[model samples]
Target: MRTSLNLKKVSIALLVVGCIVVIIIAWLNSNRYLPFQGAETTSSGSLKAVEKRLAKLKQAGEKPTLEQLADAFQPLGLIDAHNHNASSSRYLSMLDVWEEYHIDKVVLFGDISEPSAIGTDAAAWKAYQSSPDQFLPFFSGFDLHDEGSLDVIRDNLEKGYFGLGEIAGASTYSPIVSLAYWKASDPMDGFLPEIYDLIATYKAPILLHIDPPNGLPILKLEQALEAHPNTTFIFAHMNAYNSPEEIDRLLGIYPNLYADFFAGFSVYNPDGGGHPEIFIPIMKKYPDRFILSSDSGYGIESEEQAIDAMYRILYLLDDPALAKKIAHDNMMAIIQAQPATMTQLSAIQELASKNGKAYNYDNLSKLEAGKILADAEKG
Candidate 1:
């Protein structure tokens, strides 16, 4: 009778162990902590809660394997500066990547931010909640008109947004987008400076979208750089080069400035592709300053195929490793560069003193999408 009892007790213990292992496996495989909250499978779901859970999972050892992350995600470190699920031909999300390309993480910056300004920016950001894992989010165009802009930004930052807009500030134009810039303050009223002040208050970096014959969009950009040297600036669609000489000129002066080629060629010459002769050499010369952007969401072939296209630089460059850095590594480091920030005053100190006071950043209004950019180039 004693022997029989021992066998029954052993069976119960074995069953309990099996159940525990199974639960752990399931948790690790599917980041299913809060019942997969925030991932609505549709675009309209609420994700703020899910974002919190994910942070905890990473802290806990329940994170997914790198290969698991890569199953749909390519290169372990790739963050596309330009991507969207709404307002474009393709609508790729994190799940789609997991199902198709195995993309682990994707940084999402809503092409636009303030909804009151035609809401194009907000709509772009709202669409990406469908897949959060692959997307590290950045806030886009904040409406200075609304006093709530800065507060809303702080709330979102507390929620875990990575950076600010692909700051294609004033004068960014595209066929799909009509506005060359956001509804910036009236250049004459000194509203532009006020907006920057708001950004400084929150302590976020702004991505600038204008490239120019004058080197950068406004003389004020350099001033902004100098005065707020601590703020990191990203110049997207780097087609500002009216010629090779312009490229050399811009890079020569702005050591703090960072550039990317994703939109540089795609929007300008769809039929032929990017002008590597000009952009490639520049990227090679400053590999540390460039970042990769598929520019399109995973939903469209153009978006999905963007990574492969950028990756092709490996064959084109004299040093494949550096080419890979420009295409993939540089951005990864930037994304990881979350230097400790405690007091707001300390954050402001980081801005480089590039003579922001000299620039005449008076009354420039940010235009609505497709409104100003219809003829304006992405550079």
Candidate 2:
């Protein structure tokens, strides 16, 4: 009887051990598969003890409402490419912040190089993953210019990042900030090729805010094109850094070269040449190549402005086909390029409807614009 008892005990111990091994393997696999949901790290590299607090928030289930989102005139689907709420304190948790605008998706990125800005960014990453319906995250950890940046980029790509972004001040124009930023760092070193190579390998696009004197437009862009011939590059707010002539030249030269026109703050400056007329010729000339971005989501002031402006610009184009492509076709092409689920296809179809007939460029009708915005909000 004693021998029988010992055998039974041993069997139980073995079963427990096997279960533990399986659990450990599962945990390790989860970490590898889910970097966004890993233990949150601070911008300065310290891990915070938010386990209990997060649990409380999760259990309480405070579902942030649309009304909690600040009021905005435009629908949320009207996305702007790069927005940090003008660097405001309220910028944190902006994924929910934009709900009122009815924005279907926004590209959210964080500075991997910030000394004190990492923790919140990790939370933002988790939030997007938890409810991808609410946010389409553009993962960013660090710049290739800095140390360990390549690993960060590669790991993000492996984890299913939308693309790389917000590489500050490397554009074609010479903004004062871009100038100061470049002066502080050396971007042209060996890092450039490695960054471009990884970006190419991932088949991801690079988001940039480059200006001329601060960064080389023609030469640097050419090198990037040569290295990552397959990577689709989307230059946001093609300010002075990327001149009209160069946009035409590079986009013409490389099928992968592209740009978005959302930097409304600068592109729509009173003294600046507006995005539409200045670039519509190119947009029309290369309809399949470019996208129309709001460059928005900062705050009350910029809401709907980019879309409103797009209306005027397309109206100016006076070509039904050109206007339709910018308003819906090009963006649809990008989304459709990927293999989306039936649900994703349906959602995009509705969004494309909104973009297509929302406004007739030649007619200049605010009522038509209001109807589209209203429909999206209802959606």
Candidate 3:
């Protein structure tokens, strides 16, 4: 009886050990397939790996293909904080590219200037009507000097315009035309007390395009930032010509100031290499304050090209989480924080219908699908 009991205990122990061995093997297999977990995915080693791959191609006297480069980094989804819909062709093309690249949302800026009425709020309104979920429309033409201009902005905001700007102080266009031609306005002169009040009251974020490097523009921006503490200001193109240190200083001074990475001289070098070394540190230091934007519109060759440029900039950042935040989270947070009223939505729909642009999502999707398939076959 004792011998039988001992044998039974040994059998049970063997079964448990067998099960443990099976579990160990299964865990090892699962980990082999899931290589993207933990340090392996986020480390600088990943960037180095990409560099090594490129180097190998170069050594072989071969150019690195887009597919190979794309393979080097993980896929990213984006929310473009600044973009233009200059024409119907551009707008529709952008939508297709956005779909292909996994860009879920974009802030569409309208040209209130008469010179290019193609990208006006009406155009954006038409786009919004087509894909309400995909695009957020901002009304431009904020002129404090002209009461009629102010009225136009107010009416549009009341009619469900998402926000105001790409409004410039240093630019050549005037909010109000004194004569038939568009007049240039000084940044200091253009940004008025009433304009701040108007934006603050509406609770809309303003995307101001004031190029820095000039002292007066920076000073004027500071004045505006100081005066309108409650107003959310997005300084476009990473303040254009400002260095990272200057941007850091400005950010430290103004808690309300946010910057968009929208293809500035400092951000991208004329050489094939992007200015990741400059931007990565600044981005890490001010993760929440910085957001990604294509700023692609009439002039850009293709949305794919714009997206690829953005990705090149993004891959330079060592932190994947930080990259994700800049690409999508930061913009989404800003949008979600500012919810439009029911009245605004209703007005937007009415305005969109009045604009009379038919949005054919199915047709666009089908067209894009064909293009994607063709590209895949070529690859």
lDDT against the true structure, per candidate, is 0.47, 0.49, 0.60
| lDDT of candidate 2 over 251-344, digit per residue (tens) | 7888876677654533355544444367667777887766555555232155455544544444455544454455444543443233222333
Off by over 4 Å in 2: 1-77, 85-102, 111-123, 169-190, 213-217, 240-242, 263-267, 297-304, 314-379
Q: Where is the poorest 10-residue window by lDDT in model 3? A: 362-371
Quote each prediction's TM-score. Answer: 0.56, 0.56, 0.66
Q: For residues 239-299, what per-residue lDDT tens digits would candidate 3 score against the true structure?
A: 3545778888988899888988764333343421345467678788888998877777223
Error of 3 at 75 (Å): 6.7
Models ranked on lDDT: 3, 2, 1
Error of 3 at 56 (Å): 16
Q: How many angstroms is residue 120 displaced in model 1 relative to the true structure, after the best TM-score fit?
A: 7.8
Winner of 1 and 3 under lDDT: 3
Which pairs of residues have clashing backbones in candidate 3? none
10 residues in a row with least lDDT, candidate 2: 38-47
- Candidate 2 versus truth, CA RMSD in Å, comes to 19.8
